[model samples]
Target: MNFINGPCGYFNMIVITSRSSSIPIVFRRQLSALTTLPLTLSQTNKNGQKHDPPSKINSPPPLGRLRASVVSPESTHFVDSYLTHSFFSDELKISAKNGFLSRGRQLHAHIVKLGYYNVLALQNQLLHVYVKCKVYYDACRLFDEMLVRNVVTWNTLICGAAHCGRSFKSNLNLGFCYFKRMLSEMVGPDCVTFTSLLHTCIELYDIEIGRQVHCFIMKFGLCRDCFVSSALVDLYAKFGLVGDARRIFDNILDRDLVSWNVMVYCYALNCLVRDAFGLFNLMRLEGIKEDDFTCTNLLNSAAIYGSCELGRQIHGLVIKLSFDLDVAVSSALVDMYAKNELIVDARKTFDGMLSRNVISWTTMIVGYGRVGDGKEAIKLIREMFRGDTGPDELTLASVLRSCGNSSSITEISQVHAYAMKDGFDAILSTANSLINAYSKSGNITMALDCFSSIANPDLVSWTSMIGAYAFNGLSIEGIELFERMLAYNMMPDPVAFLGVLSACSHGGLVYEGLHYFSLMTKIYHITPTIEHYTCLIDLLGRAGLLDEAFNLLTSMPVEPGPDVLGAFIGACKVHGNAGLAKWAAEKLFALEPSNPVNYTLMSNIYASEGCWLDVARIRKMMRDRCIYKVPGCSWTEIAGEVHTFVSSDKSHPRASEVYALSELLVRSMEEEDYVPNEDFTFDHV
Candidate 1:
């Protein structure tokens, strides 16, 4: 008789099947090892039957050149246990890699008996075993029982906790507590401790804690430590601090590719696209061979900058290096093309991917979602499932996102049900997507239900709930929700503050928006991004506080971009504040002398006040510069076909029928005294 105890360490558990004459679809362990209590390996078979000779397996060579104080006979004995432990650990890791989990567990039990009962070493290795085998409860139980707890012990358990997918906060806290205790014990942290903490902080977005760690390193004069230093650069980059991260990168004397990649990747993330290009060029001059990761980051930067020229150059580089088939690199290429608004090019890139993974599928779904191709996004999700892969939160979130913009409440609800069924409804992202979808679909009850149920809601979740309330005309509720968010220990992020500020602007809470804007940098430490400025400008402008809004635009520490300038000019036009309108117009016209919208926005201000001559002058200037609005196009997809209609497009299949229908609709609207909002029309047209 034979039995499999399975990966969970329970014995004699019924697997509910027998008839062993045929080859077992799931094989059980046939061998094991015996232990010599004082910490040594003696191999055997599962039924206590001896098999492999324990003495035949050679121990790993002794640690060479390690500090002498930490090495001795006892250490050699410990190292022996570590080696046997490593053997079992390697087996478990291999099993997980090959999806043969039960076999790995049997091997683990065999190794355990071979002199590795030290709570410290065993706890560490057992934590790793449970993590690799993905048995979270067992891992936590082992972590709890350990008499000795060091940073590594805490790190292994914390990392294991995070790996299980949803219990990050518990592990995140454990990592922090262990680190703090280690420091209090004067254990003197190394690079690994800082890296692990920074990783959790990045997830937590605990900037205050991250900065505290940064300050501690600086105080200890360990900022020059390569690993800790590299992690700091990465952390700063994550929180939108590219300049500082770059400065740190430049200061590192013994930097590696990881260090350089951290800075370059962060550079791309902050839309410092040209800087990313410059850094890449500098790396080339330094003779640092661009690896697949380098090319991937370069592609991501290129995509975000919307520079087709750079993207094509990188495409050539990938082909030159024959690295185009690399999945990570290919995924970045796909993401870049999609973000650049080149769906055809993105499709070409996707089709060229010889090996596709979840990242590849998710990127394409996001591309389709961005362009409002709901059915395509849904079809892609189905395709991924058909291949026997489960949809992760990212997959469901992307599809739910498409439904959000399409106003497809029914589809969103179905996706919501599926997400709940797949155990993703508890994840913040999937829950946030569900909230957004329900809100956009006008199911406020359902939207609020998802929001209220999210325990320990992050900034994104809080912001989503507030935004939903504000979007649906419940401004008071939105403001109150934001206040509640502030009451929590968690600090609101820039995006969250922006939502609340916009709510205040809508609700005529001028004093409140102004207060929050000031507190944003000083207290919360979120530097005022351009969007934040735009929100403030709009807030002031809406209140007919044109002068104040104008002052904000001019006095901005950062140079105002076209969007910022346009918002100010639009507000000036509304308030009939010609002084600022003229001020904004000059900047707008010079921004792109050939931009049709700028010319039109200004001309409308003139035409609205019965200034026909000015409108004509603007039109003549447009013609002179060869500037015209791109033809007005409206596209609706039906049955997977995109049907595009222009205001007077005669080239479509149903052009005549559409024209007749428009005429009839216009007549009906005229009878009801409905005035067409001519905002879509250009005077020149």
Candidate 2:
């Protein structure tokens, strides 16, 4: 056998033999050649006898015989002694890197048997191996057993505790405990220690503790450390303190790539789009190469602002930089396009990804949902299951939202059943979406049932259930639910107030509506938005309090939006107040000049007041502007299929039959002395 040195001091041995040799002869020759090597002379056999070097054998044996002989106790001992101490440490590190925990443990035992376990350097190496293998308990045990500890040893254990993949809160607490213990023992922490603690704080979202760590870093004069500074930036950014993060980032005199990336991400996370882009430009100008992290952050910022143009530009840059194939970058791109309503581009990016995780799949499904393509979103869900990637809670929530938007009750029920079977129905977000889906589908009972099923509902659950009741005309139930939410110590957000206000409006509870509106602002400290004002105006108008509604609209602290004015105008038309309607319509026209609904509403009001000239003038204005009213349409679901009918529509496949049945029903009604109201007939128009 011939031995050759390999990388990292491991040996690579090769053996050659005559092709015609018998197995027995090859085995004998291999044993003879092994005995002649310098390594075998120091070997101790199982019987505690030493093997003498053979004199007669000079040639190497065949490979098979050599391998078999090396497994013997004496030969194994010989090889262990042949390796140097540094070489042995390297081998252990290789084993750890390969995730061979069993091999690492065996090597550790060998080190102990060789009486090298007391060596501080070797023990630290073993500790690192244990940490890398995620055998944190073993690492801690070894750490406790060490008679002498150094800064590296303490840092290793502390950092390992932080990254042990246990519950984040528990792991972070453990890390802090170890840190305090290190300090008590007079082991001053270095930059690495502070960096690890900052990371733990980031994960725990304990900004107070993070601030303490920051103060310590500054006291120790370690604030200039690039890695430590970047971690601080990340910590504050995650806590939504972007201004503080920027201050730290700006103080870094020797900023590294990580510092630049983190500051850009901080700005992006806080939705400071212009600032993020500005920092990105500055980074490029400073000649820092942008990585996948940079592109992902910028793409996410673009998604928030719905800036498709900026997103497309970034997409081009991503492709130019060859980052389009990266999973994180690609996922962000898909999300950006989806949020901007560019479903086609989003799908294209999704399909082009070489690999897909749950996030990528969820992003595409959400994009389809946002565009009101519920069918496509559900199709992706099935495809995801078939591909062996089971949908998670987020995936289910997004699909539920899509179904709600499209009013696809059948799909929603299917998804709900799947969620129940898969045990995701109990997840808070998924359950909240279920309430929304049921409510948007007009299934108020199911919405309430879902709400009741929640053992401890969150604010979203209460808001969604309340909205369902309000939208379905169960204003009393909605109002009661709001009170129940308050009783549970859950403060109502603007959305919750909106639901209750809408409910009061629909139920003709004008005083209740006004009271909630005031309560939302004064007690809850939530400023009333245009949506709230619209609800209040609609409530008063429905109750024939048009003047009060108008006064409230005009007295809004902020300028009323088109929705508020439109609601007021709608109220005037409902009460047949031509002067108020004309005044509100002029405001609506100025705000939304191209809206055909406003023109039609004004015309209807004038016609109801027998003002033919004003009605003709409004019609002429609509024609001159080429504005046309959207045809009123309604749909009904039957046998899991939706059938739609538009006003004066004769294009249905069964239109003639439907018309004949309608005529027969009218004739029968006349025979029964049924009186028909003619106020809304074409003759009035």
Candidate 3:
């Protein structure tokens, strides 16, 4: 190019500089061979996977006539070199976009062979490609070899290091190091630099560094930049500093959609539904259209706080904005309705979804399970399998829970089989749910097997195993496991304590139960819940320590709830204490006036005492109050089908046969001299 005398020759004219003192010159003869290296521009990858190229590059005119018509040969050479640089730059961008690391390396070699390695812009773009492809080693090497650099060069490396996949702590540290080096070189950071750094702080969960970034933004007078302001809002919100995030959000001069969405998300994330709604309204007032992120965050917040009314209002807005078609927004709607216990509404939303992802299917299944509709959950899973999106581990776990709630052993086993077949049984969450499901299904042996299969169980595994043992009546084993968990340095939470307390109550280990209760409160500092108190009272009541149980009930830190009083009443009935039984029954009746079980319990107590008058009065009170006993029901699985039987019911198609078999069994029992204990029989309520 005539020794850099042309218009754009200043780039080649500048002296080279680098991290090291000098750049070693390689012989042109040795490098010329690389220029002939064949470059493949095929759409197929080395692994035989086909992918579209990033974009098409425009071809330049042929050089044959161009060299002949040029005013001078040197000018033609300059134009030829410019075309080559442009071509290679576009190709490098394509490789970066598609993550074609091997192709990018080849292009780099070709660029060096063409003697354009010192072109600052070309070098910067190549660095970007390296960073984009996640080849940080090569990126750093090229950066160190570069004789000239700019802000883009540092920002590329910093942003890439900040956002690298896995092993992020070290990469984030490297990013911070790069930032320091950039400052040492007297290069001031721009808004993008601060934005990336703030994001990095959030990933590191270092609020101190986040605050320092915020200060730096202000110091650099870039705080008003919408990008920087939005980043600050996100950083503070992540650290739970809602006030700080709102402050930064309020100060934005030219607020964009991103800033508004960030502010709304901040409120939603902090569980401030009112603020989130208020900000959303303000956005509308400012003529800012709400997008999918805004709706998704608000709906999720409403779901978390159980604000069904607010969630519905948000749903209306979503429909008004025609965002119901968005998969994320629709999934949030389903989640909102399901968590609020409005299963019908949840189902309607789920059925109307135009496109459903794995999340949508999982949310609907979880909702059905939460509301005790195990069969519906199972049906939905089957439907999901029929569709494109298969159930994930969460879907399996939730459906397993539903089966457990309904006590459908057959369904539970079916789901477990599915999990095993699909490799979900090894997942920690699914495995834990399987343990609980088996325990509820009265298959303690299977539950133990599931627990044992976990190679490295987490806290949830231990808690689930302990609860399984406690629920299945293996109280001693549950207690031993709790101790073993503690010996392994697993700190017990409130749920773990509940499992151990339940074990103590079931085993009738009064002293041990009381000791563990004390340990939980004093050592673990866990506040006792109603379930904990119920277990303690039941333990004392089961052992006939009525006086002590009653005193504990009265002196409970929190008010004795229905469960506590009910436990005491059962204890009184067991020991034949008519006086105290009457007192507890009266308290329970007032607390749960509509509950037929409480009235029935009191009526049975009076009848057991031979107080016919009191029994008649109790029955009359029940009738006047329109109270009736809920039918007792049980179910069993036979040949992969479930059969349910309810007391005094003849609704089944085979009712006649079932009643006849029951009568024959009763006669057989009578012939064997079996005398049924009729303790306070219930004729009618």
Candidate 4:
């Protein structure tokens, strides 16, 4: 098609003079061989009648397409000739569709083969192209080839290094060196240059350098610049300076949506859910339009809050805004709702998705698991495998955790086999999850076996396996794991110490627990956390060392937190130490006034001691405080539906049938003189 300016010659074409502007003269000669039709044209009708060309059409007067033609990949000569221009580079822009990288790379290779040497521009683009291809070596070679490198040249190298995950010390230094040179040589770095530099700083955890960069930009009057402002927000956010990041973001002269989203994401990632939501509300009040990224951030924040109500509200807004169809946003919504135990909402969202990625499928599966739908979790995995999608390390790990509840050792092994085949067995998170799964599944040995297979376990991995042993009632094994961890010279974090202390508590190894507790502080300088104290109380309580437990709580340097107080109260209950239990209850109530569990535990303690008046008083306190014990519910997924079972709730779809069967089973057990264990489980009457 011949494309030209309008008759008035007042319009410029969007990009090309014609779609075939990149075609060169020599490339057109070969097209004649492909088709038998002679090159020809038709005349346009002007005003009334069609005008005839003089027997023949004059040759086109341009270097573009001489004749219409089709070329295949095998026609290397044609491709080389055709690619000697900047056509595909423009199309690689963000406005183009998803496969720009693929098409752009093919054209780039062809362009290089044509040997049209503009050494400077070519070297600059070559560095970027090689980086895009993840060919870091070639990128470096091309970067070094430039006799006179410009600012773009240096920025390209740094960006390429950062993009390719070449966090190698030298590469990281070179990126910084280039940034420094830009300042020293006075190349006048732009917004892109500073943002890239900040990313490198964050990756390297050079918070000091990041701060300096921020100040530098501010002094130069670039603080109001959106790109600089956003980069600073992200950098400070990453380094745990949420307040500073938020301040910089707030001070931006013109806060665009991207700026808002970046700041909001920073808040959410730092676990400041309230602040995130508050900022989101601010955005809405300011009449800022929310997009998929915005929805994703808000929903993700709500999910982290573990607030079902808030998550549902965001999900509703997404539907209202028609952003529910966005795969990333919808997947985030699913995760949020799932974690909130709104399985129905999560499943509905997942089902409504027009397309789903592996992350989407896995998020739903994890949501099911969080709601205790182990069967549904496994079912989803099976379905994913049956369909086109397959499980990643995270999916495998989550499903293994689902199997933990059933103690499905056989199924766990099967998953392990699958992991081995898919080469996902090497990921650290997967390994840790598998260890926890095995431990919970009543195979402490297998859990240990799994831990041993991780060639080198980080602190988290080691702590996980050690905690696994302690969790599964094998305190001796847990202690041994801790000892082994110490032998490897892996500095145990506070969590690791808690696991070891709890192990000692379980094994009645009071002396060992005390020794490690001391070593944890004196040798490792690790401060004892509330959880560590809880483990000590549990240890002493379980071993009937009631007075020592009371003494431990009283001797704490700081005021006891809820978990610590709760632990002491639980121990007092176990040992029938009424006075200590009363003190523990009072501390717990004062610390966590809204905790129904504390009130209920106090009432139960009074009831056990047959103190009727005290029980009455406890109940009165509960009533005055408006505290009521929420009935616990458990859900299991089967046949694509989550079956929720709750005490005193007759709303399960199979409630009538399940209740009748439960009654029958209870009757049979009663006839056999079986007594219900009301102490451990409050769910059943």
In order of appearance, the predictions have TM-scores of 0.66, 0.72, 0.74, 0.72
lDDT per residue as tens, model 2, 438-513: 9988998888888888988989999989999998899999999999999999989999999999999999998899
Model 2 bad stretches (over 4 Å): 1-213, 235-247, 270-275, 518-526, 616-632, 661-685
Instruction: List, in order, the clash count of every candidate structure.
Output: 2, 1, 1, 0
Q: What local distance difference test score does each model get?
A: 0.74, 0.80, 0.82, 0.73
RMSD of every prediction = 11.4, 9.8, 8.6, 9.6
Q: Which clashing pairs does model 3 show?
A: 17-147
* Winning model by TM-score: 3
Best by lDDT: 3
Error of 4 at 524 (Å): 2.4
Candidate 4 per-residue C-alpha lDDT over 1-685 given as tens digits, one digit per residue, 9 for 90 to 100: 2322222221111212223444312233233332111323223332222233345423322212412333443552222211222333333332123433455455445434433223355556656766666566766776665566677877887775555454365666667776776678777777777788788787777899888778778777888999889888989888889989988987998999999999899988988989888999999899998789988988888888887787878878988988877889889988888878889988988998998999999999888777666777877887898888888988998888887765566667778888888888888888888898888767788887888899979998989987887787788888888888889988888889988898898788988998999999999898887788888878888788988887888898777888888777777776678898997788788877876777788888877788979988877787788546676667654543445676777887767888899899989998999987655432121
Which parts of model 1 have CA positions greater than 4 angstroms off? 1-116, 119-123, 127-291, 304-310, 370-375, 403-414, 437-457, 472-494, 500-580, 631-645, 649-685
- Candidate 3 residue 359 Cα shift, in angstroms, is 1.6
Summarize candidate 3's per-residue lDDT along 57-80 as a digit string, tens digits.
466333332233334322221223
User: Which window of 10 residues has the lowest lDDT sum in candidate 1?
Assistant: 61-70
As for TM-score, the candidate ahead, 1 or 3, is 3
Candidate 4: what lDDT? 0.73
